[model samples]
Target: MATGWAGDGAVQDQIDATVKDGIQRARSRLPSGPGLSHCEECEAAIPEARRRAIPGVRVCVACQEARDRDAAFCGYNRRGSKDSQLR
Candidate 1:
């Protein structure tokens, strides 16, 4: 049953974790409710089009971009496998 060097169930575990993470990520991106008129982060005006389009957008495009950029550089790795930690 073991295919990889990690042993039996390791690959399956990794696949399960990846699928769970994907589901969580997708859920997080789901729209919540009515959109806010302003950006919660920067207090910038949220355009009507964006609000209507997104349905629950809390941050303006610029603020959201900045947040995404910071998040990318924050080094918060969600996939912290034990094998990686041992290395």
Candidate 2:
């Protein structure tokens, strides 16, 4: 049961939507096609183990770490209270 200004099931709906969006975002980050022997960005050789493990691996550990560090968190709140939205 949703509380406050949100109607019945509104909180659940938001939670479900958030989960779906998170899943889609995660899927988008997965590299498609065959694994590359070298990193696409730095051209460093991707380890044999990484290629075998990930299947579609493209970047080396160093480059992947860098990319991860630079990546923005996609978990931004989808629903804000009316008061918050007004500001």
Candidate 3:
């Protein structure tokens, strides 16, 4: 039973929605097709080993790391999360 303004199974609905959003976000970020020879963000040449390791890598390690760091801070925090409190 939901409390106050929330409908039935509201908490579970939020949880499911969160998981679905995460899946879609991850899929959207996946690289597809032929990757560029250099980092798209920094224009640094991609190493042969790195290219072989990650088939569709488009950015160099440093740029990719920076992107991941940025992505980490941009997601929403769930209710009651400590990160949400910090915001």
Q: Give the candidate number with the greatest TM-score.
A: 2
Tens digits of per-residue lDDT, candidate 1, 1-87, equal 444366677767777977887778867876788779988988889999999888788999998888778875322447676567345
| Tens digit of per-residue lDDT, candidate 3, span 1-87 | 456777788768877878898999888878877778899989999999988877788999999888888875467745667443334
Q: What is the lDDT of residue 20 in candidate 3?
A: 91
What is the number of residue pairs that collide in model 2?
0
| Residues 1-87 of candidate 2: C-alpha lDDT, one tens digit per residue | 555687787767777887898899888878878999999998989989999888899899998888899988756675776466334
Worst 10 residues of 3 by lDDT: 78-87
What's model 1's lDDT at 67?
71
lDDT of each: 0.77, 0.82, 0.79
By TM-score rank, best first, the candidates go 2, 1, 3
TM-score of each: 0.51, 0.64, 0.51
How big is the positional error of residue 29 in model 1, measured in Å on the Cα after superposition? 3.8
lDDT of 1: 0.77
Error of 2 at 54 (Å): 2.6
Please report, as a residue range, the 10-residue window in candidate 2 with the lowest summed lDDT. 78-87
Best by lDDT: 2
